[model samples]
Target: MPNVKSAEKRMRTNEVRAERNRQFRSRLRTALKKVRAATTAADATPAFREAASLLDRAARKRIIHPNKAARAKSRLTVKIAALG
Candidate 1:
C-alpha cells in the first residue's frame, strides 16, 4: 500500500488501464483466430477485415507495434490469397 494519496490513485488508474489493455489484446487474439479458422476466402474476408481493424486500432493505441500489425496483415492477406 502506498503511503501517499496520489500514489494510491495512480495505482488504481494503472490497474484499470492494464485491465483494459488486457481485454483489447484478448479481442485481437480472438479476431486473429477467427480469420485463421475460416475455411473459404469468402468466409475469411469479413473476419480478416475485422482482425485488421482490431490490429490497426491496437497499434494506433500503442498496445502493439505498428510493424507487428503490418506483418500480420500481410500474412493474413497471403492466407486469403491461398484460399482463393
Candidate 2:
C-alpha cells in the first residue's frame, strides 16, 4: 500500500510501463523466431533486419539490457547468415 499520493501514482505508472515492456519483449521474441525459422537467405534477410530493429528499439527503451540485445542480435545474424 503506497501511503503517499506520489507513490501511488508511481505505482500506477509502473504497472503501465511493465505491461508495455512486456508487449515489446513478446514482439521481439516473435520477430526473432521468424528470423530463425527463415529457410532461405531471401526470406531471412528481411526478417533479420526487422528483428534487429526491434532489439535495438527495446534496448534503447531500456526494456532489455544492452549486452543482452547485442548478444541476441549477433546470434540471430549468424543464424541468418548460415542459412545460405
lDDT of 2 by residue, 5-84 (tens): 99999999999999999898999999998988888989999998898999999889999899999999899878877887
- Please give the distance, in angstroms, between residue 31's alpha carbon in candidate 1 and its true position after superposition: 0.5
Show pairs that collide, candidate 2: none
Encode model 1's per-residue lDDT on 1-84: one tens digit a residue: 999999999999999999999999999999999999999999999999999999999999999999999999999999999998
- Residue-pair clashes per candidate: 0, 0
Worst 10 residues of 2 by lDDT: 75-84
**Which portions of model 2 miss their true places by more than 4 Å?**
none
Candidate of highest lDDT: 1
In model 1, what are the clashing residue pairs, if there are any?
Answer: none
lDDT of candidate 2?
0.91
